[model samples]
Target: MKYILGIDGGGSKTTAILADETGKILGKGRGGASNYQTIGLENAGQAIKFAAAAAVEQAAENLSVSWADLEGSVAVVAGLAGADRPQDRERLRAALLAQMPVNPIGLRVEHDALVALAAATGNKPGIILIAGTGSIAFGIDRNGRQVRAGGWGPILGDEGSGYFIGRAALTAVLWEYDGRGKPTSLTKRITSYLQVTQPDEIVPLVYQGPLQRPEIARLAEIVLEEAAGGDEVSCRIIADAADHLVKLISAVLSRLDWCEPGIPAAGTGGLLQPENMLWTNIAKALAGTHPQVVFAPPMLPPELGAVLLGREMLDTAVGQEEFIANLRWSIEETSQS
Candidate 1:
């Protein structure tokens, strides 16, 4: 039987799923960071290989088939971070193929944001605002036109991302420590979170220690928690994050000519949680400006969206109501198990 593999390769982790032609999920696997730009090409390739092999092995086990039997018929679709340029995509594709256990029918690689957008709208024309460890806004119009804004990574952009918020919190803490800014709870909270006795210690920990991007990004949780507790500085940070995200969405919308009423838009990533002030403020801001916009929740995670795209590549139709329902059930079951 023919099989398909879908991969979501990100800065924090890599996820791979194995599914049949009809969109029935069979197995899932996860591994460490795969953003080639952050981790280097060899490391990213290893992560993708590790995750894909695990998924394929698990599917072979479940179906009582030999691994070799499952290999030749599989179609691979990967949505990888840091694959923005055609050369980057080609390099990553070659690296991933080199690590595969068996030759597959075909392989396709795309930027991670495209898959996030696909997952948000099920390949329909809509906008997706993703604010995880990094942030980007991508949209596709009815005419198959695509536009994007603000995925320049931490050093260049990622304005509303976890890294952005965390770096801001750290800056605020440092300012407060030096008496240049008002004393805020973040000064205490950040020092404690970093296990440093004094705020100045953060300098060495960030610069000399093994502090990675995701580690710094994790500090955004502390900012959120403090904001929830009514810390003024933390609240302002989150509000600023919301404003940045709104601007990203608005820019994409303008590029897509989607300023009219009833354009479907959705959000994905850590900051877009409905329970958080970040998301609430973003929703309010967007509504005030674009009242007719329909803000929908994501229909599927990016990994599953990769699978959907893989199916499409195989000339198979997915995203029908029943198929989506089954896919959702399969995802929940796999996640729980």
Candidate 2:
């Protein structure tokens, strides 16, 4: 039997999907963080191996198939969060090959942003804005050209992302504590969330060791909470974040140059989770800029977009029902585990 493997390697975690030639999913696996930037090139290969092996083993057990019999897989696309630079992609690809057993078929690595884009629109044209550890806008214009904006990472860019917002909140907390800014609830909430009584405690945590993206991003919730409770400081921060996020879409839309109404744009990642006001604000801002732009709620997680895009790379058509069913199966299986 033939098979294809698709992987989505995020900053926090990695997902692996095993599917048959016809797009029927056999199994999937969850593994440790595979962001090359976070985990380093030396460890990326191991991370991918662990994640891929877990999925392969699960699929083997569930389908009663042997690893040796697993035919050469095709188009093993990996959409990674930090594979922005050409060097990063090269490193990730090299790492995948070095770690995995040699297969006759090949693997393809791409920006996590592009995978999210493909996931949102399938083979059709559309735009995808992802706000997670980082923020980036990716789209396929009507002419089939791909354009990307603002995936420069948290240090320099990543505006409107959870990490950015979190960092902003943390700074604000320090500001409030120093009497440089108005007293806001974030000053207390952030300290409490980290189990500390003061901002000084976080200085060591943020600088001492490896800073976790999601952990830092958790502060974004505090920012949102303070804003919800009517803190003007928090509101202004969120509003600014929303504005920064709009810039991502605007950059992509400018490249796409949509001359007509009904061009689809979708939101994804941590910021777009249900009930997320950050995402709502972004949509509202986009509306103000492009009155005719259409918004499609992301139907599947961006990782699943990596899987589906892998299938598409083979020139295969995955029907909506089957695609969603595969996603449901993966989610259910993961949940049970």
Candidate 3:
């Protein structure tokens, strides 16, 4: 049987999946961050190889296919960070080819957001809000035109994202320490999480170069914890984040698509992952402002969406039953092993 691979290479992590012609996932794998911008060519190549090999290995274990016995393989539709620049994309493409000798027709790449949209709702024309280390909203109109808002990265935009919330927490800490802003629990929570007894230590520790996004974003979780514990300032921070994201979602729905009555909107990224409670607040905020917005369960990993796109382009029709079965299997496999 022919096999295709899809990879979603994000800033913090990489996900790879193996799927058959019917879009049924056979196996899946994950690896560390493969964002070419953060890790460079050598490390990025290694990460991608690690992710792809794991997926292939799992699939081979189930199907009894040696590396030589595979009929076809493809890695088209990688939505990787830093892929916006032509040179960066080229560099990653070259490195990917060097790492894996699959057929030239089998490889492809795109921005991580594009693949996320594809995976979120089968790329059928709707908006997706992604809130992880960064935030972005994109949508396809009924006419197939695409429009995007935000996603300018943490420094410029990414409001309502984990990075944004975390940065806000740090700013609050600074403000409170200097007696310039409202007192907040963030100062204590953040300093404590970093294992520092005093807020003064944060300035030097976080600024010593090599700031980790996930570590910083963990502060956002602390902010949430504080909110849950009834800290008014923390509650306000979470509320503001919800408002910011709701605005972005509304804009995408209106500007990108016809402000139609119903659009197949879905939430994605780490913030919207099922276990994250932030999505509940976001959904509540949206409901108050507009008509009921539909929330979709993420049916496939972004890598699988990339592979599905390739499969559709190549005239492979994955039936609904097969698709659902693969999705369930993939989720179960990940949860169990």
Candidate 4:
């Protein structure tokens, strides 16, 4: 039985899955962050190997193969965050290959968003809008042409992201303090969130001090709450976030083949909850802009998407239908286990 290794790695965590070419679920494992940009190459490499080893360890318990014998893997697909450029992808490929148990025949490294879109579209033609710690809209047309917008990180881009929503509220709070903006309840709440009595004191904490990107993203929840409670400032910020995200989806859709009528698009990330203000605002806006677009949640998780992509690299490419069905069915068991 030939094995395939599929990895979904990001700044926060890493998940690795072991499956046969037939899509049989063998084992699963997790490790720390593998984003080389944040954790550095050595640490990211170690994290990838650790996750792979743990998966192989579980596979050793369930199958005939052990860690040392994993060289029979047919392919490996690692969909990693921060590995955007081809050079970065090559670097990550090396990182995953070094001191690893498996010596797969085919190895590929892809950006995390691509894997998310694959999961959403089942490798069909579609677009994925991811607004987590960062934001990016990536699409694959029927002809395999790919296009992306946003995802420039906290400073330059990441429009419609948690960090973007969070920063906008905090900035509004400061403006309110200076009497430049309307008085809103977020001033008090955001001040408390920042742990400062006066809103002006947030300057040092935000500019020259702590409040990392993730830390700032936490404030987005507060903004969401305030918007639900009818806070004008918070409501406006949420609307702006929705507008940015809608534009991202529109930008990708316009460049693709189905631009005239519309196409499939899915939402993936923290702020995209169905019950939330952001989701509603974006949905309403899209109803007018692109009526034929069917927006929904991701069809599958990214690791399974990585699995599908790995399956694509096989030589014969037969039994694809069975492979997808079994993979989907096995994911339920894996999740329950």
Candidate 5:
């Protein structure tokens, strides 16, 4: 059996999927954080190995076949966060190869953003704006010329990101405590979310405690909830986040030129869903400047984009409609199970 594997790894969790040559998704698996930049090389490799092995195991269950029946030199592609640099890709490639459960053929390590664009546009010229733990905008033109904006990590940039929202909310809470800012529901919501009663106690926890970046980023959900419930401070925080995200998209779109009808622009990541605060604000904001931008849904998730790249390595054709339908149905069935 000609098998393909796709892996999407980030700071939060890693996902793996198995697909046949026809681009039909067979099974999927998930593992822990595989962002080597934060989790270390060995841990990242092990996480990836665990996810890929689990995917094969799921495929075995789906097909009622043994590992020996499916094992081979599988075509593989891994799109990982914090892997944009060549040295990072090479290092991860070496580490992943060492710990792989099966022999890998044409195993390519790719930046997660590029695969996200493919997921959004199917290799067509377009733009993808991702705003999860971090935010970035990447755009490609007709001639394959690409431009990227934002994604500078938290200390420097990562504006319009979950971390940004969380950080801003925390600041707003402190400001309210000091009477320097307007009183809003965020102060109470944030204090409860952080498991602290007094706002003054937040300083010690934020500075010296075990509060990591991801933990702080998780607070973005709380902020979003408050925004949805009509908290003034939360609403402003989310609106500011949307503005920053729009700036990133605008900077990228400014550098590239795509013809009329509309440019295919897609939003991914947990915080970038349709009708959400950021998505709604971003769409409204972009409509004026980039009127020709068409908001499009992703044809496939980012991991499947990796799968598509793997299929390309084999120089084969896949029936797009059949594969897409099968993939969607299999995903729904497996998710329900």
Candidate 6:
């Protein structure tokens, strides 16, 4: 009863999935933030360990197997946020190995964006644009060349991300409050969302307290709500976000040698919510210039992408069309049941 473990360690949370050799999902677990760059290495390591252990334990109970037995038979692929550099990947891999009980047969750690790409494209050469707490555009060419744009984190980059939209909303509110900009509903919406009577209090709450990146990112929802309610400023912010994301995609495409009309692209992350104005605007914007581009829904969640990649580490044949289809079916069935 060999198993593979897929871990998606993002800024907001860590998710682990346990699956059998045939790619049938066995169990799943979730834990706290595992972005080693944002959270400390120790905290990130603990989150991974907690998620993996919980998944393994759940699988063991269901299979009537022991934890020790499961550990020995596992292979791991982790798609971790903040593992942007080779050294970051190595350090986090070392930390995970030291912290977890599993001595997996094989292990690979990659940037979370790569996993999103894998999930969206089924390991094919395509682009993945993710806009959650942070934003990044990652692509792999048919030649196996990989390029990325805008993953510098919240402080330096993260354009088109939830954080970007939220920060823009905050600034818009402050500008309106100071009579520096046209008054907008964002001032009232943002203040209400923060549960503060005045917009000035948001500055102190952000600077002096537990308001973290994800919390700030969540504010983008308020902006979306206001935009839907016909606020001009909010609509402009959403449009700007879409434009930034389109730039990211265009940047990646420019670096690639392929000029085929139908290059595949996929979107992921909270900011790309299909029902949101941001997502709608992005779709419309892309269709105008990149009409030849084919946009598809993701084939698998990012965690399952880790699983598929882990299996590929052992045997590339696991990525065959039939195998992937079966795997996708199993995952879908599990989700429904």
Regions more than 4 Å wrong, model 5 = 65-73
Residue 28's lDDT within candidate 3 is 77
How would you encode candidate 6's per-residue C-alpha lDDT over 18-119 as one tens digit per residue? 887777787788999999997999999999989988887777777755567766788899999999999999999898888777578888999999998988
lDDT of 3 by residue, 239-311 (tens): 8887888888888877764765677777887666553557778877776776647766556655666776666
Error at 305, model 1, angstroms: 0.9
What tens digits encode model 2's per-residue C-alpha lDDT throughout 3-120?
6777888877888877765666777777888877877876666777778888788877878744565546455778887888788898788878776764626678888877777777
> Model 2 scores what on Cα lDDT?
0.76
* lDDT (C-alpha, whole model) for all candidates: 0.86, 0.76, 0.74, 0.85, 0.84, 0.86
Q: Tell me the tens digit of each residue's lDDT in model 5 across 167-283.
A: 888899899989999998988887887889988888888899966777778889998899999999999999999989989988988899765758989999888888888788999
Task: For model 2, give the 10-residue run with minimal summed lDDT.
Answer: 65-74
TM-score leaderboard ranking: 1, 6, 5, 4, 2, 3
Off by over 4 Å in 3: 71-75, 85-95, 209-211, 273-277
What lDDT does model 4 reach?
0.85
Which pairs of residues have clashing backbones in candidate 3?
76-108, 79-111, 79-112
**Model 5 C-alpha lDDT versus the unseen true structure:** 0.84
Model 5 quality (TM-score): 0.93
Q: What value does the lDDT take at residue 266 in candidate 6?
A: 89
Residue 152 deviation, candidate 1, in Å? 0.8
Stretches of model 6 off by over 4 angstroms after superposition: 315-319
TM-score for every candidate vs. truth? 0.93, 0.88, 0.88, 0.91, 0.93, 0.93
Which regions in candidate 2 have their CA more than 4 angstroms from the true location?
A: 85-91, 102-104, 209-213, 313-337
Pitting candidate 1 against candidate 3, the one with the higher lDDT is: 1
Q: What is the lDDT of candidate 6?
A: 0.86
lDDT of 4 at 332: 90
